[model samples]
Target: MKNFPLLIILISLCIACKNAKVIIDDPINFNDQRKNLTLAYLKNRYGIEKDDPTIDPRMIVLHWTVIPTYKKSFEAFDNPTLPDWRPDIKNISGLNVSSQFMVDQNGTIYRLLPETIMARHVIGLNHCAIGIENVGGTKNLPLTKAQLKSNIWLVRYLKEKYEINYLIGHYEYTLFENHPLWLEKDDGYRTKKTDPGTDFMKRVRKAVKDLNFKALPKN
Candidate 1:
């Protein structure tokens, strides 16, 4: 306890320096171990019957946390229980639910959880969706270009790794509401959400078009 102040100072410095966009070195090393953990999570929470069978990913869900930093975002996902208002999560892993990756304003991407794991980021599609959360989407701290590039790079990387078909933003998740993408058991129940903004998602979608995850245009 005596070194608490020093510990905090050190932590602050480390955080101040953490950046997710360090050239996005090609072959960012998929971390198969982490990927496997994600896969296990998908099965348990979303009831994805098979992993080896080419799991054709149809959508990529995007999000933005009103929360401020990476550590806080990490802490949010690290736990197994979401906020009480998140009734959508209680029926699933009981974990708070987090995205596979989070991009901070500085363009630093942190792998809070594994992609293979079905996170509770989106409703009705946790099993086959990839969730990417941006650090801040609030009025005080809007999205950044660095974060945009990082997202593009990360999306490209994931597309190369998986057989993903559609890329989606959290806001658009509801548009597909009552649609066939609701293959997961949690197809019903819960309210609507719009995250990372429709415009931002459109930009990301354009960047990842090569991956073939684009949804229909907004009406």
Candidate 2:
């Protein structure tokens, strides 16, 4: 009887894992206005030799959109031009930054862009990195436990789907300054950022430790 109970619990867990879902609520598209801009940005900002924006992802970078709600986050990235506040880089390329996936407060995962297509999320690594942005992390709207679970699942999913090797937070992105993944041509065009918090990353790393993804090089 005791062994039967354990078997039932194991079966239930397997069923739950099998039925796990990450819905695609919205997708940001490259319309007539945005396509040419994206191509120009790819070449000017990242110095990509080819016209194609497709990327063979080598790393996964996580971010938290301080923009409280999913609607606003989507609206903010809908346009292809950089916001006026960022005058420094706007001159280089009018590319508005975006990510591959976004996790809302309730854990709904949205695909903003294609995984193989480049997104201007991580400054130096957009050429070979995939970015996942969470909906809320500001002082007013903090991230939820649901988002943490979603991120853990998403990371594992991406690793299985792609040739992803390194998993890093947005803040840790600067560590790749001189690494091959860092594709920016200008040495001075760097921004300091701390996002998705240290604790959040620690928890994610602990959860996905079994995946055996490589850590950022110390050099």
Candidate 3:
């Protein structure tokens, strides 16, 4: 009869672990300055005059850090201000580019910021999109299978938690330019992207096909 209680405890633990994915909390700098910059970006770029830097998260944009290593990738986003190397974007705003979650090459998921907080990851859709960045997308350091698995899990997890309706690769953001979700004010302010590759997105989408996320908008 004593063994019966032990079995119940083990079963409960397994169920709890399965429901809670193992995501490490590795936060990036979202201080006062960063918060101000985000609000400014929302007002200037998207015309959203909000009191707080938060979003409803209607979309999830997947990306891969071309930076090669997890450490370098995290460092690139850890700062509150934009790095000088990204002159193309730094001129537009001082808000450093960041994502809500970053997946390591080995499939470890790290949450960088709160899911509802606005991150300066995707253009035009930052106000409603949650970003997921996978480490290592350079020619020499392509995303691994482990990353694909993690991304699938994350997409499913977020969809379950929020009202996520669309899944897209970074390169596909332009298609939403004229869609109601598109919010960038500057017609000239657009950047080309090819992060987290088409193949990676395809695999992840296929894995979560049952979820029936809305299709990408036509360009």
Candidate 4:
């Protein structure tokens, strides 16, 4: 009977674990390029055109900022125009790439846009994918443990909130080239990428394997 209080505390902790981390709303400039890309994404994603900018969010695509710090990452995304370096991609949507959420090195998650909105993070799957960008992934700066935990929590939270079908790393996105989720309009718009590497993704998948989401189909 004396252990009843301990049991109650344990139960309370379990309930608390169910609660999600706070997602800070740190918006980027929703410029004209972003607006047009949103419509284009909607058209490709749903095969119909609507006035609003939204997505079905069939997949979650993870990325790494490669920019070292969170503020620099935000600055890179804050610019309305696509970076001048990628002429191939800018011609298609003029919209600079961005993600729905980003996890800082310390595990703090920031919501750059709504969950069901389109982001230009992945090439072929942007129309139906949710992008989660982490702060670091350079050769010198690897991702941290805190970021991993935050990503696990974030992925689970998103899965519960939406009908997420697949969870993939940025590098694995090309594997879906002929699959139904691949919706990029321009075939030539593809770029070589290696952000948020295999090891990070393996850890994330191992943590969230119980969610029972479908694995990437065999190519």
Candidate 5:
């Protein structure tokens, strides 16, 4: 049958497309100033005096950028220093908030920083957590199903590549404050968070149930 070879080719292409990941290398500004700020944050906040601004990545923390579009989201993290509007956090450190990966509403995953590098996304666990931010989490522009799928895929990919033992929503970071993983020195320096809401995290965690990430410490 002449059509047999054509069918096989079609099937192979379908499989490849199905398994293909849509990750883009859209990095933010991580110049010398950012590196120095990160090192300072590590030392002052976590008491880690490392020469490099890298982390072991024992956890993956998920977040949602309240900013609507991918472009705006990118701009928010493009700078190395915290913006003026965030004076509350600027008092602590000048390092801008950033994440390792950001998932667009259409499910396009963008790598903003190196996975092993410390990002100022989460509060206490930035020293050992890789942050994944999803664009659009406002009441009007909630996260989409495409983002959910992309997050699941990213979680699996990171888990396979790193020694990640925990997966948590940004809101869940406070629960680890007393856990051994937390390292922030200033006990009063905590911020409230509800990004990447409970529903989104529940769905993602359900999908990756087989990964068996350690349970979040009881609040």
Candidate 6:
């Protein structure tokens, strides 16, 4: 797959989404500026030294922010600085740390940072992991059909573009604890996460079946 051209598509998609308002009923798109921002985020947040030919993305880790809406989620990640809890990237860059994408309850997929760049969504495998955050994982507000659909589309997009092999939920990331870390630079470190849910990942896996990727049964 042509990763670079797909990136161009993603950038155009991000550009198209700039004027978009979060409407649960509508299919939201993305824009170039947003795409570039995500790419820039990867560079600043992870301090990726250079692309590693061997660093094949093995999994797509699903997450949830427990936040309310898309606007709120966007504002949260768009902050040029990450919070103190993000000690993982404290030494790398002052840029606020986080995942590659955020899936809103309304099913809007917001790109935070690019997939190629390491995101802090999960620890132990930040370098080879791609994090997808879904908004609204709270008591009253659960993930919606719209969010699920958007997540599926985004997952398929990534798998095809990056030749992604595994898919798992944030709750299941610990399963990769023994897997070798691949930062392509850093020695790697442990990270913590417990967002999103199993049922959610099952649904995502089902959605990406055509890609020939399957979710690892939870241990």
Give one digit per residue, the lDDT tens place, for model 6 in 171-206.
776675445443323445445555677677778777
What does candidate 1 score in Cα RMSD to the true structure? 12.1
Q: Would you give me the overall lDDT of model 3?
A: 0.92
Give each model a TM-score.
Answer: 0.69, 0.90, 0.91, 0.90, 0.94, 0.64
* Candidate 5: tens digits of C-alpha lDDT, residues 18-103: 96797899999999999999999999998999899999989999999999999999999999999999999999999999999999
Best by lDDT: 5
lDDT of 1 at 150: 85
Give a tens-digit lDDT track for model 3, residues 1-219: 879999999999998787555889999988999999999999999899989999999999999988777899999999999888999998899999999999999999999999999999999999999999999898899999988888998998999999999999999999999899998888899999998898888899899999998888887
- What TM-score does candidate 3 reach? 0.91
- Model 5 segments beyond 4 Å from truth? 1-13
lDDT agreement with native, every candidate: 0.68, 0.85, 0.92, 0.85, 0.94, 0.64
Error of 6 at 181 (Å): 4.0
Candidate 4 TM-score, C-alpha based = 0.90
**C-alpha positional error of residue 3 in candidate 4 after TM-score superposition, expressed in Å:** 6.1
In candidate 2, what are the lDDT values of residues 22-69, reduced to their tens digit?
669477866755667766666876776666668898899889999989
Decide which is better by TM-score, 2 or 6: 2
Error of 3 at 126 (Å): 0.2
Residue 87, candidate 6: Cα error in Å is 7.6
Q: In what order do the candidates fall by lDDT, top score first?
A: 5, 3, 4, 2, 1, 6
**Candidate 6 overall Cα lDDT vs. reference?**
0.64
lDDT of 1: 0.68
Per-residue accuracy of model 1 over 90-164 as CA lDDT, tens digit each:
665445566767888888877755566455677667767888889889889888998898888888878878877
lDDT head-to-head 5 vs 6, winner: 5
Q: Which ten residues in a row have the lowest lDDT in candidate 5?
A: 15-24
Please give the lDDT score at residue 219 for candidate 2: 54
TM-score-best of 5 and 6: 5
Error of 2 at 215 (Å): 1.8
